[model samples]
Target chain A: MATLTLENVTKRFADGDDEIVAVDDVSIEIDDGEFLVLVGPSGCGKSTTLRMVAGLETISEGAIAIDDEIINDVPAQRRDIAMVFQSYALYPHMTVRENMRFGLEESTDLDTETMDGSVERTAELLEIEELLDRKPGELSGGQQQRVALGRAIVRDPSVFLMDEPLSNLDAKLRAGMRMELQRLQNDLDVTTVYVTHDQTEAMTMGDRIAILDGGKLQQVATPLECYHRPRNLFVAGFIGEPSMNFFDATLEGDELVLEGTELSYPLSAPIREELEGETELVLGVRPEDVKILDEATDDHAFPVTVDVVEPMGNENNLLATFEGSELSINAIVDGMRHVQADERYAARLPESAIHLFDRSSGRALHNRRIDDEEKLLETRV
Target chain B: MTAAERTESGSSEGRLATTLETIDSQRAALYAVLLGLIAFYLSPLWGGLTTAFKTQTGFVQTTPLAPPTPEWFTLEPWELAFATMQGGLVNSLLFVVPATILSALLGSLAAYGLTKLSWRGQIGILVLFLAGVFLPYQSVLVPLRQFWSAVDLAGLLAFAPFLAERADLIELTVTHTAYGIPICTILFRSYYKTLDDEMIEAAKIDGASAFGIYKRIILPLSMPMFAVTLIYQFTQVWNDLLFALVLVTSRSNYVVTQSLNELQGSMAQEYNIQMAGAFIAALPTILIYVVFGRQFAKGITGAS
Candidate 1:
């Protein structure tokens, strides 16, 4: 087991005469046995960060420590890290048994008998015992993925670096593998840094997710922390599916004058205390938090016309336009709710579910408070 | 429905139509070209075989196309061809086999460096080897001969035990191997370049050093290319008459090509014996083509 720490690690690529900063100064301390995911959009340097950890790419600045030893100058082979590439990168020419045995043969001095036993055991763990004699080319994508994982797991490296390992599988298989991967990581309890652009994978799989944007580290937090208490607008918009809705608003006393007074939302005293000095602000709310009220009886509620209703199996995402404003906000409700297009409904922005951000800096002034027990229960399932 | 039943019922009619259309479209042209190619390639072999079996009187009287009659069919030319070319055949084998193997080993090593290793001035080294491929062999023949003579003392000193008084064979082998390196390196390097770099990187991460990767990964992967280059180089060196003629002074040192040439005497040209000798000289190459033809084509086409 190892605690991998990136102390302000940076990577730069010299393209022609200009130096492109692929990964700017990024720091994160991954605890021993923690499965930390490096999550971002494309070209966000998450893969570069993981590659630097694996010693595949050199760190331009700062240091990387495994426990306490700085391995900035160590080559990939000496790093004792086994990586599963997005393509699965299994040796196409080798049988499944041979592919699993290759790392032990090269990196360790185990005898053939012991090595074969380890390989057989790994194959059994992966439930690929029948596939031991088959080549990678003969296997399906899911099977190939299992073999790639087996190849790395058999090595029992200090840490595991996985680069979008399940992105190639179909949705059904990807979902299945995602859970299996989480289970395996828990069983092995090896520090793993998984890189992926898929937020669902990051949200569901990581014990803690490190979000990167434009080669800069945005936030490092638990999945529920990132979901409910985002530090900035980017994190709020990135973590949730259908994303958080944002509206230009002004903080006038205890109420938010949204979109030039088209809608004025009353803020709670506690939320107002947190946003005391902010004037020009952005109000953020998740799709599920935008409640469709029975009738407009209060100042915070406004009648909005539902433009389109998308029926996802468990929830219906209603894309509705606010009254006297062109702004369209999404509200996810119960799937069985008979919401329709061109229907006027009173939408209420609950103060408890409100997130306020600074207009200029995009920094969140106040985030909605989430109960710890509820979050823990949600994560358990 | 069962998958086999669905497949059998769904596409068979369409496939039959497509096959019929294809055959109907190219039928006349395909047969015509096939016939032309067969005649073009087989005529010389037929003429040689019939002439070799023919009596001397039949060769003078009958047309070259005449099939050998039972009375006319004789094995005298075959006996003469075998007896005469035996020494040259042995010498050709001695030269070609070692030369091919040495060149392939050296070329594979060079190819591994050119394709897999990272070093400063790698492109410069590659360009140097590439330049050897296009260099005119005829232009350097005299210089190469002179160079060999200049290096003769060292060659004799180093390989006296190995060469055992046949220092000219050493020169020929060295010269052939040197010339063979460039083309073989070009072929092998291009072939190796097509392999995934991830394989090497993964091997390294698996704790394989550069030489370890080459020995375990590259050498096994390169068997087909080695077979192709070996067969190609063997044929070229075996068929080389000019080098053997220019380098070897004695009749005993003559290779197969020179021996085939010597079948036609100055006073009386024995066409039967000459044809028989040429056919015999070509047998090894024919055997190689029959055995490794598919792999040779696969390697070249895959590289190009």
Candidate 2:
């Protein structure tokens, strides 16, 4: 196992006379035996970053090292890294046995008996023993995926690189593979870097997730840490489903007067201290954190009319607009909640659950508090 | 009212009949055109066959299309043509086989390099190779002859095994192989370009070197292209008269095409012998097409 490090790496492509930077100065150190996911939207330099580490794309700047050795100049063949492509890229011309045996044949000096043994073992691991004699064209998609994984697994390389390997599978199969993949990674204990645009995969699969945007690294932390304590506006918006709602507000001592809205939210003492000198800031809160209060017994609660209700089986995501305001924010409540459109409901924005960011800089000044910091710390370790 | 409805149905049926009649006439016109096309293409072969079997006197006396009489029908033309072009046919085989195979091999290797390898100015190099295809063979005759003389290896032919006595055959083979390459390269390059790039990348990650991938992966997968290019190059080299006429000095060392040309000129009065010799010279190419025609079509269509 090896720790893969990318120190300020960049990738540039020459398009005619213009130079397009595919990946900007981004750095992340994936620890030994840890699954680090590089997650982003399409064309966000996530795949480019993964390719750079795989030695498929050349680094325009900085260094990529594995266990203290710089591998920037090393060719792909000499890098001793195994990768599973998004398409699976199984050799259609070769049977499963031959496909799995290819890497060992090319990369290792093992005898025929040993290579055969490894191929058989890998086939058994993937439960594809019956498929060994079948060509890739003859197999189903999930079967082909197993063969692709087996091809990489048979080699037993130091680092495993997967570029959206599960994206091609159907949703149900993808979920099953996701769990199996994590189990496989744990059992193998090989340092892995998985690239995907699916936030679900990034959150559940990675030991730590590195979110990228516009060719730059936005945040690299544990999934929960990125969700709960995002460093900036982008991370706060990107990490959560239904996204975090933002409202422009001005800080006046204790009262946070929202701009263009008839609402003045009272801040707690600690939050007031954190936003004391900041005059203009944006208040952000997660959909789950936006509580639907039964009664407006406190000043922090505001009566809002629900514009739309999306029943998601376990939770009802209510799109509500504040009283005398055009701002519509999402609030996810219990699925059994009898909420309807055009109904006025008291929505509470808890002071401890609100995040405040600098309006001009998009940098977070204060993040939501953890109810149990000790439990958070324990989960992080 | 019932009569009016019946009349309307009858009028509609009449219109349907008219449409059917029109379709029948259209089909007849198409068949007529097809028959005309068949006659246009097949008449020459028919005439050649008739001429080949007729006696020289009968060939001169009758129109080329006339059937040969029992007394005039003979194997003499066939025997003479075979006897005259025996050396030429042997030499053509010697030259065409190796030249075609080598040209295809070289083209595939070059195509693999051009498509799969990452190097600067690859497009420029590919354009250069493609440009060679548009160059007419007639335009390069003089320069090619000069270059050929300078690099002629006929003196070293004695060191080689078979075909040693036929020295100029070496020069002929080299010339045909070189000329065959541009089109072969184009064919194989476009075919290789359609291959999944991930396969090559995966091979590299698997620690297969460039040559290893070409041999173990590319070569096996390109059997159709091999057949296509081989047959194409074989026909081109086998039917070449210009290079053979210019390069080979001896009458005994002439390729089959050159022999057929010579037959046409020397036996101007002997039309039957000449036609027979021409047919014989084209037989190998015909056999090649007949054998690998499906593969050739598949290769050109880029199905495999």
Candidate 3:
């Protein structure tokens, strides 16, 4: 319903004589009705950022605005926002009906009939109408989750804030609720700020993902963009499962020599020119993007010894290492592909699929070159 | 067949028999000791109840443990005891109920503020409140008496001077409540410390003001804790003889403990009347324990 802006918001906590910055100055402008996911590793200030927006935490610097109106000084109750906590925070003594009706009663001055109508309608939408009279202790975890969602939806606030709301559920139930939440947000068209440490949730649920690390904003982009073209090394590693493999190298003439190995990748003239006297560079590539070849096909393909092979039902995740080197690289191949351990296989880090970063600064110099089909998919999305 | 099927297999019955055989003599001896201890504790209560029912001639003839015989039993002692205590009972009731509830409610509020709401110097204030819990009443007796003696609450209320006698009970109620607050707040704070902070955060985001969150969330969730504090405070205030003894000299405003003490003359005489009065005075607290003991136990254990 409204656009949310976090313009240079920061949070700091004081301990003894030291002031520790929990969330550094980071800014993100979310469009109206957009689903923005704040995602990072533990202690990365993602939750702090979400809490600052929810007014549960005070901002140590900068301001937050809703619909172009400053709400930095607004108390939480007057901010017109609803949050779904990880534990759901349901009043245990109250029935599901009362839980849904609570926000309406406290935030809105709606009469009894209007409040009941809203509660009933929200319960019906969540398909929890039959559970209205049941207390939270009596309901299952999934049912309690639905009731939590119903409570937030019943308020119809300007924005929705969810903090790892699906983390407490089982895997199957969490996946189901993830889709259901997306549908609900789409139907309601409410601005949402979801916080999670799970990269899968960030990748699948967010309209745009904001990745944070060490209390600093790394990137804010669509999931595909973050995957294919991470703004820096942290986003590349943090946004993917079994994350990206990084190799430190130095550019010398037309060759990028990976340290601690004899392998040198001969980059094309154009890519070598793009290095622009920057000898210190990092080579980054996704695990899935690394192709396993039957034999060495080109200088880009290096024969790696298979250290270990993990057979996932849908894909095979292999820990492949450069021959006689301590460094390891993960590659995911088709589950049906025959792979073995302690054997050499040619694994090609294609120039088109590789990402290059300035080694010292951790800033990306080049990203994966997407072809026509991915371009078509991007346009369609 | 079901029994025979387990004959060749390891069985719970076999394990039970082995356990019983190994510990039979010790277990029996332990039960005997526990039974003797139970009887020892009940003997005095039996003596008190029987002595309260016996008439003067019956009391002189029979031992204190002897149950009342139909020929010797009479209602005279009970009646005399009730008559002596009827006024004190009413006066005590006036202060006890309000003091118990007010102290507990105020303590709960203090606990919520201390644990949930953050402010500068909160830790210092909590330390002070905890310090009050360890402050012994015997140490403060003279000052407590002097403080109430100088404060005329009737004049403060602008009431008629004739009502001043009844107003002493107000002073007693206020004194009990004030003294009761520190311990009550400590007990309630331990319980409130277990409540999740996220619940308050959620309520805040749901648009509930501070008092509203307390009313809707904390108060409803605190029934067990309330029961624990109420029973605990009730016992403390009702059994208090020190404060009641020092503060009140007028028989018109004497609490039940004072009245019971007054029933005992210079010498230990009229054992029957004293026993009856003591039993009657104990009935309210015993009734409260009987009704709320389970909840009190749960609340106490949950706090730990």
Candidate 4:
């Protein structure tokens, strides 16, 4: 097991007259045996950061260490790490067995008997034992992916780095491989850093998700914490499904007012003490957290005209326009009820579910709960 | 019943159309066979093989349409063909063996350097080599002859001890090798372009040095092209008479092409021995092609 750490790592590329920063002063620590995902939109430098760890890309500044050993000058072959590339870079000429046994034969000190045993075991584990003699071009996409994984497993490296290994598969295959990766990671217990632009993959597969934007890391926390409690506007907009709804609001005398509606929320005493009179704040609420209220409860709820109702089987996605801001609220409604367009309904926000952010800095007003739990664990130990 | 019978008759007419189309195809195939026999079966090269084995008197007396009778088939020409006194077989091997080995090694090296190196002037170097493909060997013969003389002058200055004994003979052989390398390099470089870049990168990341990558990966994967180059260069060097005639004056130094030319010029020429020498000169190239013909076809198709 290995704990990987990036200390203020940065990457820059020459762009004619100027340098373009791909990864900018990003520092993150992944614990031993933990599955950490780096996710963002395209050109967000997640792949660059992962390549730096894999020794494929040179770090322009700072250092990366595996198991507390600085490997800045080490070559990729000596780094003792295996990677599964996005293209599945299998040797087209070699059989499945040869592809799995290549690195061990070329790099390791294992004997032939032991190497053969390991290859068989890994093939059995990946359920590709029948495909040992076939070439990669002869197999299906899912089978090729399994061979790529088996190649990594046979190495038994300290860390396994995957660069969007499932991005090439169809939807059904992608979902199946996602579950297989999670199960395999758990069983192998190797520290894995997966890079992808798909937020759902990051959220569903990661033990902790790191959201990046403009080459800087915005937030790194558990999936639940990242979704429920984002640290900044970028993270808040990036982490959740359909994204969180944001509206311009102003703080006034223990109340936040937005869209001509004044809703009161009880902040923690420390947060409340920091808010001054007549300050500007952004009101944020997740789609699931907003509820459609009855007509009698309109006093506490804001009325909005529904623009479109998207039926997602288990839940309904209601797109509504309140004043000038458009809000997309995902709510679990009874399947039998008909929700028509242009219907005016009052939407209510629970006091506990409302999030406040400083409009100027776009930073969250709440302390992260994961940090509190880590502190408690440190004290207990 | 009348409408149903009419519909069945219409379907039978469609089946008759399909059968007529098949008969048309068969008629066209028969015409193609008639044309093929006239084009290939009546060609001179087909009759020349049989003529090569017959005595000159028999070849002149017999009708060309018939094969030689068993009594007319003599091993005398074949026996004379193997004699070293004519020097035709030895001349072909000397030119071919050295030229084939030299060109294959040089061409593959140039290819490796062109594909793998990161130096400046790479395109300029490649363009220079490519320019050679456009020039006919005859166009550069005058300047190339002068250049070989200058190289001989420089070699004599550099190796005075060795050159004092037989400088002229040594200089003639060196000139032949110098003019044969350009087209061979171009052939191998073009062939190397079809290989995947990922395989090279994988070899690099597998801790292979430059030479190791070439030996283990590039060379093994390039055997078909290498054989193609060897066979092509062998034929070119074997058939070359202009360069050998200009460079080599001695009887012992004449290549097969030059020796054949000399044999044609001698007074009271032995027609049977000359025919035997001509067949011997052609045998090596034919043998090589027969051995590696499949590889040659595969290499040409795969490289493109």
Q: What is the TM-score of each candidate against the true structure?
A: 0.89, 0.91, 0.93, 0.73
- Model 1: how far residue A321 lies from native, Å: 3.0
| lDDT, candidate 2, B138-196, per-residue tens | 98889888887886566666677455667778888888888888898999998999999
lDDT of each: 0.85, 0.88, 0.87, 0.74
Evaluate residue B251 in candidate 4 and report its C-alpha lDDT on the 0 to 100 scale.
68
Q: How well is candidate 2 docked (DockQ)?
A: 0.64
How is the predicted docking of candidate 1 categorized under the CAPRI scheme?
Answer: acceptable
User: Could you tell me which 10 consecutive residues in candidate 2 chain B have the lowest summed lDDT?
Assistant: B1-10
Those runs of model 3 whose alpha carbons end farther than 4 Å from true positions after fitting are A373-381, B1-23, B55-76, B156-163
Candidate 3, residues A235-307, lDDT tens digits: the string is 8888789989999998877899999888799889778766667889999989999999878899989889888
**How would you class the docking of model 2?**
medium
lDDT of 1: 0.85
Ranking, TM-score, top scorer first: 3, 2, 1, 4
TM-score of 4: 0.73
CAPRI band for model 3 = medium
| Residue B67 shift from truth in candidate 2, angstroms | 6.4
lDDT of 4 by residue, B1-304 (tens): 2344335445655555566666786655555555445544544543555565677676777644346678777767657655543574565575567767776777788888898645779999888878865778688778866776666654555657544333434544455455556677777777777776545544444444567667766777677787788789778777777776666655665567766655453566445555666777788889998887888887888842
Worst 10 residues of 3 chain B by lDDT: B1-10
Top candidate (DockQ):
3
lDDT of 1 by residue, B1-304 (tens): 3344335434654555566675674664455455556655776677788899987886877766567889888999999998999988888888888898889889998999998888789889889899998887678878877886677644456645555456667668988899889888988998899887767777777777888888878887787798789888889888887777667765667888888887888987788888889889999888877787877777767742
For model 3, report DockQ: 0.68
| Poorest lDDT segment (10 consecutive residues) of candidate 4 chain B | B164-173
